[model samples]
Target: MKKTRIVILGAGYGGLMTVTRLQKQLNSDEAEIVIINKNEYHYETTWLHEASAGTLHHDRVRYDVTKVLNRNKVQFIQGEVLEVKAKENKVVLKDQEVSFDYLVIALGANAETFGIKGLDKYGYAITNVNAARRIREHIEYQFATYHTEEEKKDGRLTIVVAGAGFTGIEFLGELTNRIPELCKDYDIDQSKVRIVCVEASPAILPQFDRELVDYAVSLLESRGVEFHVGTAVQEAREDCVFIGKRGETPKELKANTLIWSAGVRGNAVIDNSGFENMRGRVKVNLDLRMPAFNNIFVIGDCSMIINEETNRPYPPTAQIAMQQGEVCARNIAKLIQGKTNLENFVFDDKGTVCSLGEDDAIGIVYGKKIKGTAASVMKKVVDDRALFMIGGTSLLLKKGKFNFF
Candidate 1:
């Protein structure tokens, strides 16, 4: 009898979790497992903000995929994903093709510009490892150039961040701390450098409680970060951005560097693959499979799970992705073992912690609100826990953030 073949696309949090769990549970005779990713290494998507701000080295965020995956049961393929031919049950890669009996699409997301003009060409998004590295180098270059130029453009020292969501706020937290160090190195006055966060909403971190949001905003402000709470970025230009409230005339804010952390949509392959989706994300079934195709599972940012309480979509986070991966893996294994019933994916609301640089943070954990050093400590714990989840003790000890105040 031929063995069951399971292929997972994109070794992100979801895909890696599924691969990790399935390999340990399934025997050699039952099935064959293969995971395809564009890169050989899997990086922590959460730690990207720190790397982008030059506060954390890019090397710390990623590790070789082989280090965690079992080679005997799981075959690792490194190739770019072109598209998934859902009707044919095959994946088209840049250089090859793969057929699957069971498929998991965990291809992750792309930065969404929301129809803002010039954003594509002028702004930077902290999307991946290479993108984060480019941002760190780009900011460093701007500071160094400003120091050497006889005539310095004020815009060279100005950074306009388009959103104050989780990514934007965390980046600002690191950037605020990094600026002083950069100023000392570049011989530039700290007063001359400006870090501005513009949000269309009335408050920063709209999802967080007002108390937490206020504390974060106040703390960032104390560090000389400016907030345009109700301002929207009308357009992005090479040298500046036009910003204004709903009915007001947009004013140009001269800024050479613009980072857009406003939003992200699912991977482009989801659309190209002809999945029934909105903005590249499939509204996955309770079993975490695409309703239109029973054999295919979609997880992580590429899949959408709606919140019944709020009548809205749950925000895609690493926590939820990991949960989905584990559930999806169990279901796949059950089906392989000739079982009929499959488990549903459920997201347990643990809490949320947003870091303010390395030493400070805000969180709501298990119904208790925390801030300052306490929250910061929790943030590191959460990060370490994630490492422990996928790669076990060795990975945690190897890449865990141990520092706490």
Candidate 2:
């Protein structure tokens, strides 16, 4: 009999976790496992802000995939996935096509521009390792070029961040911390630099309680961060951004650097593959399988599940993706064993902790709200936990955040 071949796409949290669990449980006699990703390194999408702001080196946020993956149990392919032909059970890559008995799609998300004019050309988004590095270098370039200009434009020092959501708010936190270091290094007047955050929502971090939002706002404001809540980015021009109240005339905020952190949609491959998706995310069954296709499992930002309490879709998060991955591995194992041991994917709701730079944060755990240093510690612990979960103690000691002081 021919051996079953399982192909997993992308190496994000969900895909990696699924592979990690499956590798440990399965033997060569059962199935052959393959993981395809664009890069050999797996970077923490959650820590991109630090890299984008130059607070953390890009290397610190990513790791070589080979270190955690067992080559004997799993084959890792470094290739750009062009498309997935679900009907054919094949994934088309740039150089070759591979057929599989089962497919796991965890291709991740892309920056959502929301059809705003000029954003695609003018705005910067810290979506990946390269993007983060580019943003950091671009910001520094602007600071360095400021001194060389015969007529310095104040706008060069004005950095405007679009959105006050998770990515936006966290980026601002790191940027604020990074700005002082930049100003000194470049010999630029600290008072001349302006860091502004614009959000369309009524408040920043709307999911957080009002008290935490207020505290975060106040903390950032003291560090020279400006908040323009209840506003939207109308357009992004080459040297500035136009912002105003909804349905009103836009006013220009002259700034050379405009970073968009508003939202993200799932990988475009999802829609291209003919899966029924909203914003590139498929609404999956309780077992994390596409309704029409049981052999294909979707996870991470590419999969959607409803929150029974809210009667709406749960936000795509790393925490949720890893959980789905654990369940996904079990179901795949059951299939291999010729037993129906499929498990329903569940969001455990351990809690949430949002970092405010490296030293400050806010969180809710077990129904208890925390702030300041305590919250900061929790944030680091959460970040470290991800590394520990993937590669164990050695990897954790190598990449974990140990500065709790």
Candidate 3:
């Protein structure tokens, strides 16, 4: 008898966690597992901001995907996923099509532009390792060119970040730290450099309480960071951004570097596959399976679950995705065992931490609010814990953030 073939897509936190758990829970004869990813490695999506800001090297952000997989139980495939043929139970890749008895869609997300004009052409997004490296390189080029040209463009020194959300704020934090080094390296006056954050929301980090938000704003302000809260980015250009408050004329913020961290939608493959989605995210059943099919599951950014208390969809987060993966693995195992009952996914709210540079942060952990160095330490611990969960002690030590001080 042929074993059940399980196909998992993407090597992100969700997909990796699912595969790692499945390898341990099921025997070789029970299922044949195959994982596909566009790249041969998995990068910590949380660390992309640091890499984009040049504080952390891009190489340090990613690791070989095969390193964590048990070769005996899993086969790794490197290819871009084109689409999913749900009816046929086959996935179309660039090179070939693979059929599966069970399918897990965890293909992650795309940078959401929200119909903003010129953003696709003008703005840089910290989406992946290559994108992060591009932003770092582009920023350095602007700074390096600032002095050498006969007509110095002050716009080159101005950096506008489109969003004051978690990614935007964390990037601003790292950018502030990196600016000093850049000024020193380029022999430019630090005062001439500008770091501005534009948020559509009335306040920065809207999820955090007022106190934590205030602390974050004040700390960043001391470093010459400008906040334009209750403002929207109307448009992006090659050398400037148009932003404005409601009922006011949009003003141009002249800056060669426009980093967009405003929002993200789920992968296009989800929509292409004809699944009903909101911004490419499917609303899965409580068991984490796609509503129309029990053998198909969707997790991570590709799946959306409502927070009953707030009546809002829970933010697509690494913490939630990893939790979904744990539950997904168990459900798949039960199905393979010919069991009717499957475990329902209940998110254990661990908490949230938003970093401010390498040494500062703010968070609500276990219902307690924290900030400064203490919060920063907790941030590193959270990062390390993620590494531990997927690859255990060795992967943690190899890529963990050990510097709490």
Candidate 4:
């Protein structure tokens, strides 16, 4: 009898975790496991903001896939996924096709532009390693050319960030911290540079407690970050952004750099694969498997599950993604062993830490509120913990944030 072939897509948090666990659980003769990703290295999605702001090197956020996966048990294929022929049990890649007996879709997310005019053509998003690197380079180039350029355009130093959510706020925090260094390096006046955050919602950091939200806003304000709340960015142009307030005419703000961190949906491949999804996310069963297919599982940002207590979908995060991956691996192992019982995924609510640059942060962990240096320390601990979980102590030592004082 042929061995069961298991194919996992993408090397994000969920995909990498699943592959690592499965390799240890299943013997080489039991099943053949393969992981397909567009890039050979897996990047820490949560740390992309640091890369975008140039505060952290891009190399620090990424890891080689071969280093983590056991070559003897798992095969890693570096290729772009074009589409999934679900009905045929085949995945279409740019250059080839692969058939699988069991498939796991964890391709992750893409920025949702929300039909905003000119955004697709001009706006930059902190989506992946390459995109983050580009944003960092673009900002640096503008600063470097500020004096050399014949005309001094104040707009070149203005950065407009759309959305005030977690990703947006984190990025703004990094930018605020990096601006002073950049100004000194480029010999630009700090007063001339501006970092503005525009949010359509009535408030920013809606996910956090009201008190924490206020604290975050005040912290950002002290760092010279400006907030334009309850306003929507109607359009983005090459040299400026058009924003509108409630019952007001749209106004243009000149800015050479526009970063859109508003919202994210699942990868487009999920929709193109013909699976039933809401915003490209499949509402998976309790076991993390798609409703229509037993052999197919979905995790990370590409999968959605309603929270029983709140009656709302849980916000996709690296915390939940890693948990889901562990559950998926155990359940897959059960099926291979002819066991009937499958494990249900239960997310352990540890806490959330929102960093305000490298030194300050706010968080609610294990039901206790923390801020200032304490929260900042907790934030670094969280980062290191994630690295430790995925790649062990050695990997943590190499990529972990150790200075938590």
lDDT of each: 0.93, 0.91, 0.94, 0.92
Per-prediction RMSD in angstroms?
A: 1.5, 1.4, 1.3, 1.5
Name the top lDDT candidate. 3
Cα displacement (angstroms), candidate 3, residue 99, comes to 0.6
**lDDT digits (tens) for residues 1-405 of candidate 2:** 888999999898999999999999999779999999999999999999999999999999999987889888999999999899988999999999999998999999988899999999999998899999999998998899888974537678999998898889899889999999999999989999999898898878977899998899999999999898889998998788999998889998889999999889999898788889999899999999999988999999999999999999999899999999899999999998898868888889888888889799988887899999999999988989998888898888899889433
Tell me which residue pairs clash in candidate 1: none
Q: Show where candidate 2 strays beyond 4 Å.
A: 150-152, 403-405
Which ten contiguous residues of candidate 2 have the minimum total lDDT?
A: 146-155
Which window of ten consecutive residues has the lowest lDDT sum in model 4? 146-155
Please identify model 1 stretches exceeding 4 Å from their true place: 150-152, 403-405
Better of 1 and 2 by lDDT: 1
Clashes of 4: 0
- The TM-score, computed over Cα atoms with residue i paired to residue i, of candidate 4 is 0.98
Give the lDDT of residue 23 in candidate 2.
96
lDDT of 4 at 322: 90
Which ranges of candidate 4 are over 4 A from the true structure? Answer: 150-152, 403-405
lDDT per residue as tens, model 4, 35-82: 999999999999999999999999999989888889999999999998
lDDT of each residue in 79-183, candidate 1, tens digit only: 999899988989999999999999999999999889998999989999999999999998998899996764537689999988999999999999999999999
Of 2 and 3, the candidate ranking higher by lDDT: 3
Instruction: Choose 3 or 4, whichever is better by lDDT.
Output: 3
Candidate 3 C-alpha lDDT tens digits along 3-86: 899999999999999999999999999999999999999999999999999999998889999999999999999999999998
